[model samples]
Target chain A: MKIRPLDDRVLVQPLEEIESKTSSGIIIPDTAKEKPRIGVVIAVGTDEDLREKVKEGDKILFAKYGGEEVEIDGKEYRIISRSDILAVIED
Target chain B: MKIRPLDDRVLVQPLEEIESKTSSGIIIPDTAKEKPRIGVVIAVGTDEDLREKVKEGDKILFAKYGGEEVEIDGKEYRIISRSDILAVIED
Candidate 1:
């Protein structure tokens, strides 16, 4: 089943950070990792105002602890309201 | 000093939740308190697009961990981007 957000909500797929490696080639452990705050918009709510401002495929910066986490087809996704989105990152 | 958010950012003052009391009149401790997700908009960004959607004194629902925390004149406030706002509560 596809996940669709209600009202002004949106679905996002978080982007993973590149693993940090020390000069000696040692990899950092997950325990020390900080939460990723960036993601790509997968779907947007049907609200007319929200649809006008945001669209699918946009990369965004979101709050670290924002959104409800869900696993879809084994991939993790977050369902967040429009208010949880921070900024749209343009390349 | 007054804080003005840049771009589409907004400054918010989180509303404190009323302590829940049982019939016996026991006060709940802070440790069990959930983070407040609702706040009052103190200031809004200068972006024209954002200004049309949000206004000062509007109550909003936001991501709990989305904004940067700062203390101004001994009052706690959060600075968050427009995208982090979820919904506006009209009561």
Candidate 2:
């Protein structure tokens, strides 16, 4: 299932969170764990200017609590506007 | 204390989360809560082009799971790249 962002929004699939315990070997129970804040860009918006600014596969760093929450195909994703973007990762 | 961002990085102070229980009044324990994702722009980067792209006071929506986490004066913030920004709020 392909997701498309409207206007200047971008669809992102978050990177998986660490399922194991932390470096200290303290197993984090489900309640104490923080949701993962890393993700991959799935699709960009229709804005020509935004399209010129970013691409589909660019890796980026963004706010952990930004964007609107969305679930697709039993998976979770976010729809964030282009202005919320922080940086484009080169790699 | 004032913070400045380098290059295209943006310094954002996240908005406080609901300290009280959720609407359901379930009294969500801290262990089961998620980190706050909403933030206010503390500072914009030094890139002139990027500076023009964004401003210091603009409210933005971004990826919930993005940016590098940093601590300042015992407070936590994130330094996200510009590309992670999703939208600029007009209001």
Stretches of candidate 1 off by over 4 Å are A19-36, B1-7, B10-66, B69-91
Instruction: Evaluate model 2: give its lDDT.
Output: 0.62
What is the lDDT, from 0 to 100, of the residue B73 in candidate 1? Answer: 45
TM-score of 1: 0.47
lDDT of each: 0.68, 0.62
* DockQ values, each candidate: 0.04, 0.06
For model 1, how does the per-residue alpha-carbon lDDT over B1-91 read when each residue is reduced to its tens digit? Answer: 2344545898888776542132213333556454436778988865789999999999887776775664444466677777789878765
Candidate 2, residue B38: the lDDT equals 50
Put down candidate 1 lDDT per residue, A20-76, tens digits, no spaces.
121112222333233325678899987877787778987665666787999899998
Q: In candidate 2, what are the lDDT values of residues B8-74, reduced to their tens digit? A: 7787765555522232232334563443255668788767898887888766655555666645445
